[model samples]
Target: MRLPEVEDTVNGPFTMIWSLLLSLFASLTARSVVNGQTPAGLAPKAFLSLPLGTVKPAGWLYDQLVVQTNGLAGHEHDFYHYVSESDWIGGTSYYSSLEEAGSYWFNGMVPNGILLDDPTIQSQVQQFLDYVLDHQDSTGWLGPEVNTTKPRYLWGRYPFFFGAIQMVEANATLTDRVVTAFHKFVALANTMLHNGEGLEDWTRTRWEDFVIVLQWLYDFHPEGNEDLLIDTMKQLKYTGDPWEDVFNETYFPKTAVEDLRNPFPVLTWHGVNMAEGLKALPSTYRFTHNQSDIDAASKGWDLLFQYHGRPSGIYAADEYLAGLEAARGGSYLYQVIGDPKFADRVERITYNALPATLTGDMWSRQYLQQQNQIAAKNMTPNPFPEDGPYSNVFGLEPNYPCCTVNHPQGWPKFISNSFVTTPDQASLVQVYLGPYTVSTMLAATGNKVSVSVDTLYPFSDTLTTTIKATKAFTYYVRIPSWVTNGTISVNGGPSRPVSPTNGLHAVSVHAGTTEFTLDLPSEITIEERPHGSVAVHRGPLHYAFDISRSSRVLAQNAQQPLAVDLEFDATEAWQYAIDPSTLTFHTGTPAGGQLPSPIFDSGLPPFTISVAACPIDWAEGGNTFAAAPPTDPACTGAVTNITLSPFGSTKLRIGEFPTFKAT
Candidate 1:
């Protein structure tokens, strides 16, 4: 698709060079930029940030992604063909699957190939890219023209928006195609929105989707096309007024519990809407350069975290603002504002809610998952407001297929967005901790630096970063607030507690190789939850009650049964109360004291914790774990010892536990 080239409206090309040089020298560019500068002026350089395919997943994370590739992400196109409607990738109702496949291939398969140098994964990635580029329409629209005859009208083209972002990540050449398509679509969408005819139920609910992609394009554009980007932003309906209403009037987190009994419209309270909408205001902040817009984004998230925060650090929203639970959106928040708290939250969600909600093999997922969930089965009466009986089941389509396609994005994107460069392009920020490789261009020194981080993070407390750089550069490392006695040692330097500025521990590099060793102490902490219940935590990983389980294959395609689609039922009782005072933690292995095999395997956690507990009189309600544990449950038996496992490892285990006082 070829569209007329948009002219530069902001300034001439010489102005662009001057802006870049000024950014490097400007005193105001120090961690904080002057309030009203453009996002690009304050924006971290993308060249200085690691690309998606650079970092390859290892150990359990790699296994998870491969499982997805083998299952839904890799083979979804064979069973469900969305391109038939318009002979285009993103053409029919199944278009979301295509977007999911693109992200999965680019972020998962492509990167896996780079890390392992596997020809099979590499070939698959190239084939997908060719198909996408060759099939682009002349008008730039990737999907089918509006399906006017369908009963359910969704005017907002999410797959196109999502697929466009994937194209940006996949191939730079395809960006022009994406930009042109967006311009044509946005113009038509704007006309319809201005006349109050474009916004549909699902489209309005996810109106912020287009804004996020547009913001990415604007900052990415080397040429001065700010007007084209801003015009597209203004044209999108609800980009202005409706979203402002959410920032101001919609106290969803505060009122979500009350609204559960009396539900709100699903359009506003949907789980995915809340997850994706977290980026809406912050994305707009790029163009508006308004501090209020950014503030609103942070404030809204803060409220959501406070009122509806789950034990895993994911906010609650089942099908309709259920409660603090899974449908992971924590990483998106961290990406927006670069907050360490958000980064910590991302880890908690990634380690716990993300893997636990889906099967160990990453085949299926639960639509509504909670910190206290003990069962993953369909029920006549469930806790969720409007999800089906199969909402909690582990299957291909479970309750809704949205998660089948959407959930794979959680890990892949998290791995890709692990690092971001500062606005000056002199420093790099390591946000999410994991085993990966980072390659970036230091604009300040004109040096290309590559840092390889090797560690069993979340599972282990130590991380080693080995840097290969042309010259010296500053690397800003995140020191989580929970680590009071943490230390960052450079080249085996003296280990001492380092104070972080805005949660970042900065290290300056000299010419040649630099090695940094970070030690995070794992301390046992008991956190009090709703109704006098408590959650057990050791560093970032939460511990859950280890339970015996039995499985039955409800549905699956051709893949391995255990790896893809199946369901498990609790074979043992889960109604026990643990006494916090008797808690004793243990490392599973002796050599290096490393984690055991199958890091997140249910019933066989890598690490173990023993605690004295007694059977409780608590009962399940609405076929789910009781919303909150009984305030003080009566002990039913002797204080026998019980074994505990990491929250992510258990398939059907209790995370939040009822506490009983021992006499």
Candidate 2:
């Protein structure tokens, strides 16, 4: 079969006969490729991801997840099942323990399991898998029979769909079972949609979630004859509100800047829904290949970030699209399109907002994290649009359990997608800076390449990648636009300056082993945010003025008996303003400490900086932080020395600071 030759602007269109022949040729070629493994040496521009466990997290990334394993992701089953009433392994609730188990398996277990082989992680994963495989009904559903209570609510099965997909990606042995189950589920779902059985509101808006699973199956299904996949997509296509329509209008951008405080209409306001909604276009685009679909996806992101983006690079989703507070949305976008901007956004959020939202031990997390977050306490009229009063408080399921289960995905997914293979597997795309080892087959020569990266990135700017390949291949490294002085040294050769275009630096290497060192020097730049407040950033790491803080557990067994929730009280004055120009920085190395272990943690950070500043009179009140830094606040006291740490390092910090004139 032949594909219609795509013409450039200068070239004219092809004849109808030629187009038909080309289409036939392309279809046959696609069947050959998809029915088997995608042929090597057919590299596309970007966005094809490597399989799970392709890269093993190391150094800071590894340690961060270790802390997580000690916390929620590894042992949530000890407290309760995925759903509330269900016991340890299975439950009747459609979305509880099952959801948590699936996400934990995909995000936590498969990717990082080999690195940190904790018994609890291993045991729980096996338990969940055993239960799921054993309980799967003959018709294809993994849990619970169709009941009168929630008949036709297809949303609960999404976790199983996603989790099963990851299992197949991680271990091909599970593909047959997973695919068979999904096929059965889809058959049932198609009937329901056709008959209008039990499509709940969430099932409608969250239909894209189902489409995502179908697209994944269509792309990688072993048989590759998934005409049923097309049918499933059509069934789900009309379920959700037209996200493109709303995003195209003034709704997002207008509300983003003007009324960030007001609640959005029900359809658009939900945070997790918005995050999941980002996939609506790309999921559809995969089926239709319509340029408009891809275009709409990009436009949707632009409006989301333009109006609602937080300094941490995550959009605020404190239950709703709370535009200013940090939320988890960007990384999902990065997964869809291998855009370096999304990678950088993920890094910023992973380094700053992500860790800050959770406690040092990863025991608890805040539902909402503001740039100017001064205090993290429970409030009656909380800052969030619809979250509970304890939304800002650091605790297990403080506002809602969604974040409790969903938050674990942030770090693990970043690790899995740190580096991606181009579609044809000819090149490797370094999406984020981190220490890891990548092993994959290079399409250029059909030989395997293994790369190990060493660096204390985000905290430090230097990275060293050592590559061993059977044959030479190209490596594309992304250098952010903000980086001015970036250079790369090949095999200890002369350091050459790299002028990154569109945030990429492509290099060709010779066959055999080689080492490349990259040096990126960060320049401290202040960004003006909402209400004229300034945020300090060096590289991807956001810096904040450290405030003395004390914490007390407000409720024990609050959400569950084993879960402990804590509220923070600011011990020192938090309303000081500093002059950006007058700021002087002092660097310090590892201070030996016991608590906040693994240098990345706040108290024992691998590096620390002290800055000179003076206290200025800035007003502070309300359940939220001061709306904005006071305009020209008067100097309140003598100049003082204050320490500034990475935003992630600060449990109670003032990241967005008020600037005052020097006396």
Candidate 3:
């Protein structure tokens, strides 16, 4: 089915070019290299991502990262065979035929460790890096797949190198070793791609990742080998899936993939692939300088959400890109295009969808999460076309080990990318609102800026930012599109209504201590969904019916009892249709000035909304998944006051509900 062409509203060709020129001007004048090197020859990015560890989690956000540190993310390698004894680290064991599980762990662990500044995790990462770097083959290849005869897939190395690059950026001491190793691997990759040796189906479809790392190397540590790097990018693009063409032509799928005919385009429809491939066209534009590539990138983004988007800000992809899954990719798009809409999308995913996948304590997670998940148990005859019965269950490995390792990247990357510098290095851009601190030097002004944000954002309406800089610089704070009447005040001065330019409100600061408070008023919003159902939102958080739940421990690791796989079942009635007319929002402070160790835990969001609702006969499909809310659900019980919590805080939830008239 041909999808109607979406108008280029947010990132039209003219807007894209204008943003690029502004970024380019900043790049040429800025002296700050704190966020690593700016684009060398490629298109100038609107914002330059700071090196990992430059931005540190603080306040409640810090507690969340600590929860992750004490949970599965920090300890998966201790007993999980995939990471403890994998081929990537010289063990005989393998996650599968392909040696990617270990790489996945490394990729996530690198940022998790760096952001927390956890010495134990940093040491573990260092040990693995030392081993991988020391074990480079004589053929200039990395990893354990060096057989010239059999088919070798290069997909795993993309994540590994991506993590390695972050490590180098965070700790410049590892620069020489990492740069040398990558040069060797790039040489071998050039040879392999030329002779058609290592490019397999997975590699061909997901070549943008390889190109991204190549661009990183060329910009930062090319070692006078720029031609080799650019040539490799061309080779990869030539052999890879034509994502630009895919989005530009009528080849893109317009309907749910499962609804389409047989012989599905598995490569394009795969959920994870689609999430990763969203950046392909924009990535290609960096090299090709083609305006259509940029246009297609924006058009593909619009089409994706139009056809497959969920209220939680993610699309459905239970393995295929059809229904809701906890996967997102717009931070990169925001950086590349400098569009607030991209940043807004990332904020939505982070606040609503990402946390929905993981247990509140950050221990276990689901392979697939739904917008209206009623239960977290093994489901037979489920909606997922390619996932197992246990896909929605919260456990150590739910349906697959892929999410177990890959989910760690979600929060850590969000924290790392929350604060970035404009290309000119003269201005600091706060792309996401959160409790964090940024310490970096601005290249243009040669000033050291340290900003500490203190607040329980999304839960609370205000954020207090404290800035101490050696020299004056401009600070750009992102004003989310959700805010209609926001205000900012400096040093307890009279509040002034914010007038944002391109979704960012800029404030100039002096050389010494400066503090400002931004208050973005929150209002309860009712969003009408398909069927007569409605979803509620306040700020970035999606509110849900927090049905009381009970947990049953299904399995536990023998060695580490803390590592347990559990399933949650709703204990109380969950079929409630809300009365939006009676909704009331409430707020409070943490008990003792310290947030809960796991801030996402139930009943700890510091805010709640009470609304009148009635029991409705919402049907369950496949004996597992909650069927869509009925078009005209009838009240089955008397209307009673019900409390709704942030969607991220609940295990068993009704995020989308059918509304009914009350007599």
Candidate 4:
């Protein structure tokens, strides 16, 4: 199923170059790109044209190294120092960004960088890795609980082992001690998975994640086990997303796909999180081809990304449920770092909502939410399994402390990734914004190119970059698959067409000038995931309507959650380009037209509609959730005012956009 061509009205040059980059990406590695999905590379393989970018790549690798790798805010090594982080893979904090981080670590493959680079931090990371590896039994299992502690647990040990190796590889540059340490850990991890009954801890489905990592390790260190590598992928295809309990209903309730005795635990999930991961089985299958793996991964992401794409480019997590009425659990940490589609999503969810939970300077509310569902701090003296909101921004208590420590990795890495160019000769300018200075480690010369970028971006369409190269080579630049009239030129000559007319994943490059100009036309268009669910968008920006209703009429003594007025276009103005008779979106809005955006981003604004409301999980100062409900925080009796606020504004509020249906 070919995607329809969107119009290229943004800017011509920028559009051309960007398209070229993405096209090259598609042509070279579309193997990973799912059929009917956009033509973009899901991993760094696409950036081969520029080796510098490939080896080092663009993004928070630098900042993440500085903060997370160096052990900022109590995170010694690997994800965090605690066990209870929630909302994986997106955001700046530690434990708070788990789900996404575990997944990202699998593909981003950057953890190895820390293993050898920071001696102090590496020791800490190695200690954790050593603990898991050494403690494993010969039957192929490692770790204390198979990683089943709320958000932090539950993950199979394969990814953790994989991350340990990745960190070792990256840090090996500094010391062979890193190599020996990682090798020792890998030996134990591999031994446990292959021969030990420990593999039983996780479902047969998660076997592939271990296989994938093993494959990578074996590829780099042929001395590693190959049998475990193949067996895991094989098992993953047959068994999918592992289950916590077969008989349990409340926790692992029989919902989405019941009837079948063994359903989900088949190496896939029900939404985009699982979709993109499993769909690539074909590419991975050849090593040991299994169509089932690809099928499972594809189906899942398709369902969620299509139905749950919030206005912010993120597939909203209504706590695993889909559609508009769902609550928000927006986290980019799980979104693959190699793919920037979710980078935009990460930006959206992390910026506004993530920061809103913190102090003005980013320290306060421990629990963060897109909806007002949960709005309390992680109360101290809280017990594990009893304390909910694994990682909140408020002060770190003993209970759910993962996010308190883990969430710290989000912001700095986001900033670093925002300006990516690794030891490889490649470059990926993830977002369109200004004030970000990008520095790339050129693979061609083992040198660096300092790029001072200054632009208003989304606000304006021009990006001015001062590229100071350490060597001369064909340097490529990206053109977001979305830009229409994008153009780039080295030293302001003239822009040439480098890519297709329309698409968000695109790129272009010039020969040798130090200065360059990238022009983008604001051909704002709304995008939708499959299933016809709409998320209002303009380029990478997802907009939302802050409903001040039930709270205030605006222009008053406003408490938290800022207030503002918005006017619609009146002429073609909000008018539908409809057949009129059909009453469909016709040419304008659709059933899900006014769909709300997810409010969460690394450095963006928060959307707090009103503090007047509360989520299902609520305690004295806020909301709480417990897998085991008997100990869960009880909500105060509702009565007078239940208000909603924008996702970005309120510390104690609900989503700015209330649940609404079109008139």
What are the per-residue Cα lDDT tens digits for candidate 3 across 111-180? 9998887898889888888877776789876665433245556777888898899999898999999999
Candidate closest to the true structure, highest TM-score? 3
Once fitted onto the true fold, the runs of candidate 2 whose alpha carbons sit more than 4 angstroms away are 1-45, 81-115, 146-148, 222-225, 256-265, 325-332, 558-562, 584-587, 591-596, 607-612, 623-627
Candidate with top lDDT is 3
Candidate 4 TM-score versus the reference: 0.54
Pairs that clash in candidate 1: 316-323, 316-324, 316-325
Better of 2 and 4 by lDDT: 2
Q: What C-alpha lDDT, on a 0 to 100 scale, does residue 344 get in candidate 2?
A: 76
lDDT of 1 by residue, 379-401 (tens): 65756666666777777777655
| lDDT of every predicted structure (CA atoms) | 0.60, 0.64, 0.76, 0.36
Please estimate how well model 4 matches the true structure, expressed as its whole-model Cα lDDT: 0.36
Better of 2 and 3 by TM-score: 3
Residue pairs with backbone overlap in model 3: 26-424, 31-443, 31-444, 32-443, 316-323, 316-324, 317-323
Candidate 4, poorest ten consecutive residues by summed lDDT:
571-580
* Candidate 4 lDDT over residue span 103-182, tens digit each: 23332223333322445544544544444445444433333333344422223444464455555544455234434443
Q: Give per-residue CA lDDT, model 2, range 330-449, as digits (tens).
A: 544555555556667777877787787878778778877766666777764455556666777888777667667667777777787778766666777777888888888876569788
Per-prediction TM-score to the true structure, in the order listed? 0.83, 0.86, 0.90, 0.54
Select the stronger candidate by TM-score from 3 and 4.
3
* Candidate scoring better on lDDT of 1 and 3: 3
